[model samples]
Target: MRSIPSHHRLILAVLAGACLALASPAIGQEAEDGLEIGDAPAIMPVDPSDAGEIERGARPSSSTGDANRLDRGERDSAPPVTKGDKPMVGGEPDALQGINIYLRMGTPLPDVPPEKPYEGEPDTAYGAFQRGLFLTAVDRALPRAQLGDPAAQTLLAEIMSRGLGVKRDLKGAAFWYGQAAQGGDPAAMFKYALLLMEGKEVPQDREKADDYMRRAADAGNASAQFNWAQILVAGTPGVRGLTAAMPYYEKAAEQGIADAQYALAQVYSALKDVPAEKKARAREWMTRAARAGFDTAQLDMGLWLVNGYNGPRDYEAGYRWLSIAAARGNVVAQNRLAHLYINALGTAPDPIEAAKWYVLSRRAGLKDPGLEDFYLGLTEEQQKQAIDRANRFRRT
Candidate 1:
């Protein structure tokens, strides 16, 4: 499977963190206490050509510097924040609100299926295509595409979109993708939808884009599944999209989409009115996300396990996860881990060890006056030891 791009991963982290802030009243309190909540992650627009290649399974090139060409208004508009709104602390935003999250996060486009050997004998055209002979492949496939071969049209679209052997022609690529989509190719449908949504060389038609997105998702494209779910949760007309988005999130999460796993965990955890059994499921999803390397989920899981929320307390496990997140430079995790160390929740209380983490957390711009006082109260030798530990930790 292809990896998510780094910028896309950052966006997912910011979105998850935002949703988490919405769900945790502690975040509001932290803000009021003069702690830095951190700036919202910046959105870096992706290249439109990269979007086409991603949707068609081609390797993305170093950006051609076209990221800024995308219209910011089409991509960065968030849902309106109304007057008197306190940002819905301590509960999951409803599906409609989730749409705002999706908008803010920005879509990372789609992924095409991995290349496979053609059925039975390897077709010469695809064989060349797979072997990196883009010009040869295009030469061979052009006739077939002209003869109405959906696969050939799709291949040509991929080549044109990425400028593999020819000059980039987004309009040409969109035309071929539309043809393949009309021929019932799910990948083509997805690519076409992206073009439609962006209005790049094609008229922007969100209604048609939505229809095509649903079609591609229903056809079992994992990327389509996740994107369509976001659209549903964001709401349409009078419909509450949450009831519809759940299954899609599940499908995408099970398919190993880390962002989907994180989103699912947030949805489950935010359902304040759900039964205990349902909440347990939420914890399970959160653990899945934590294991998937979502730092926010790791922090949350550690807190949940430490406090016995939604399940029995497992201080050792909590300490393990919190330590993992702290090592990755999460200040909140560092602070919490220090608390656990000082309190002897999972291990023996060691003021020196607690002081080490407290110092590190504070350096990361998290204010903890109480922890500061405690650290200052230690003996000179203990303070020296803690500072030594902190220096060693920072070196790593």
Candidate 2:
């Protein structure tokens, strides 16, 4: 048996969370809940050394976490509120309250064995991880798991892998995950493959990893499908690129997988031999992902909207979406918003607004040449003022 490298352990952690930790739009009600993007919760990083802890759901809470992420969907135009054009009312904000965004219809709390009935909501492993409440979720459910409940198996595996209330143990975790995978859980399939590849407390096998990935992708695991497409597109020498990959990507994109939608959009946009109709379809995909709150998609979609690519220009709409994206801590959107604000084109220019957004963009890791120029253009006193403003914003 090959030893799984430490890096592969990290991959396993990512794969495990990838299935359940999809970023969905914040579903919220209309109130003054500050939707400041960077202020949102952080997605836990994949940790190789702490694979056992993370794999079992032992997540340490940061002040910020990506609890309220969004996904792509056919958006009904913002409903007419009596207050007129205001920020988005529902979706992402509601998600913060522990509601699943893009709640797919399914039987809530599937049948667990007699020993495991009524553990809790079966839809998420996050709350346990966040509040350090792993044991409460696990102990209450393990009896049912021992009695052959698939949901219990899945939850137990998550607890084992993430180290929620228990000490981390990869091999034991894989056993539970395997039980869930055998019961036809798509999420388990992806996690199983991650473990196989990592060889973390399990035997390493690339062929097995590929098989699990294929199974997960076939089962409509959007992240798995997108990643499989990436593997195929990259052409791993002996593994020939499969034409079969395209439909998988399309399926995932249709499910509002932002990465796939973005890739599909790019493919169509750059196709020289494609007909106008094909280009139109590509733009549609871009539009789909953009509205889902993926930053790259938002930036690309905003650009297309501004340029009237495959449609008429809608600068106001473009600005609105772009502003939303920038607010979400997307550096690209920040830079674009800054420039748009600076130019005062379409919307009135406010240098202070531009400066505020620019500071946000900087925090998002954008190194805009124009921002440096903007800074230099300001008087020494103004530069000090901007610094103070940025610091104050951070403290808030």
Candidate of highest TM-score: 1
Model 1: what TM-score? 0.60
Local distance difference test values of all predictions, in order: 0.67, 0.58
Q: In candidate 1, which residue ranges exceed 4 Å CA deviation?
A: 1-142, 146-148, 156-183, 192-205, 236-239, 272-279, 348-353, 378-396
- Model 2, poorest ten-residue lDDT window? 34-43
Q: What's model 1's overall lDDT?
A: 0.67
Query: What lDDT would candidate 2 get against the real structure?
Result: 0.58
Model 2 TM-score, 2 decimals:
0.56
Q: Write one digit per residue (lDDT tens) for candidate 1, span 79-111.
A: 555532335434645334333443456654345
Q: Estimated TM-score per prediction?
A: 0.60, 0.56
